[model samples]
Target: MTKTKAAFNGKRLFIRLYCPREFKPKCVTSSVPVTRKVSNRASKRIKRLAKPMARPIRVTVRSGKWKKVSYLIKPGFRNKVSKMAGKRKRLLVVRDRIKAKKFAGRKFKGKSRTVFHKHRVVSGKAR
Candidate 1:
């Protein structure tokens, strides 16, 4: 008798936010707050609003229980995986949380930190 485990590959996909280097040079700077005793809140708000954001990146998990599935390099694989991942609401929540966190900090953390916010099964693997 022969025993064989089913072929299984698990991947995790998530979105990342960033600010393009060029955007910084083009972003408008907020005016200096009044030198008076009044609140500087308005200027702070302007500064945040003036911050620029670049298009988000869809990233696959790399080096973990779920390994990075290199679908982007394969023809048509990117679209297939994207469509599958799109149906998972958990990924959207993860994206939104990251967006809110960046907005609060007024900067892009990019891929500096590891986030394990949520997970869902996509196709046959755990994403």
Candidate 2:
């Protein structure tokens, strides 16, 4: 007679069907719902917040020369920073970490070496 066997291979389900002697076995496999692709909405939001302000913000280095650093503002507040600039329309700077902690908790998260502590708007004429 014919017989069927089912087995699970990792995240896939496999089935085998065969007849006793004359017929060749057939195998079928399908992906199982054990795993799923997850989208990180938080990271996406943070990236969107940072993208418009592409140019690095200027900061004073140890030697007294100005250094350019790119940073991401905390999500859900890009518009607020834009609004702060008002008619002046200045570039945005992610505030230094030391000063930012007073405004929000866990304000920044990333594997990048640069860290953002807060957010500020500066006039184009300043730098």
Please, what are the lDDT tens digits per residue for candidate 2 over residues 20-71?
1111121111111111122234566454444322223333223212233323
TM-score against truth, every candidate: 0.17, 0.24
Candidate 1 Cα misplacement greater than 4 A, ranges? 1-103, 107-111, 122-127
Pairs with backbone N, CA or C atoms under 3 Å apart (clashes), candidate 2 = 95-118
TM-score of 1: 0.17
Worst 10 residues of 2 by lDDT: 26-35
lDDT of predicted model 2: 0.26
For model 2, the stretches where C-alpha displacement exceeds 4 angstroms are 1-60, 88-127
lDDT of model 1, residue 73: 17
Which pairs clash (backbone N, Cα, C closer than 3 Å) in model 1? none
Candidate 2 vs. true structure, TM-score? 0.24
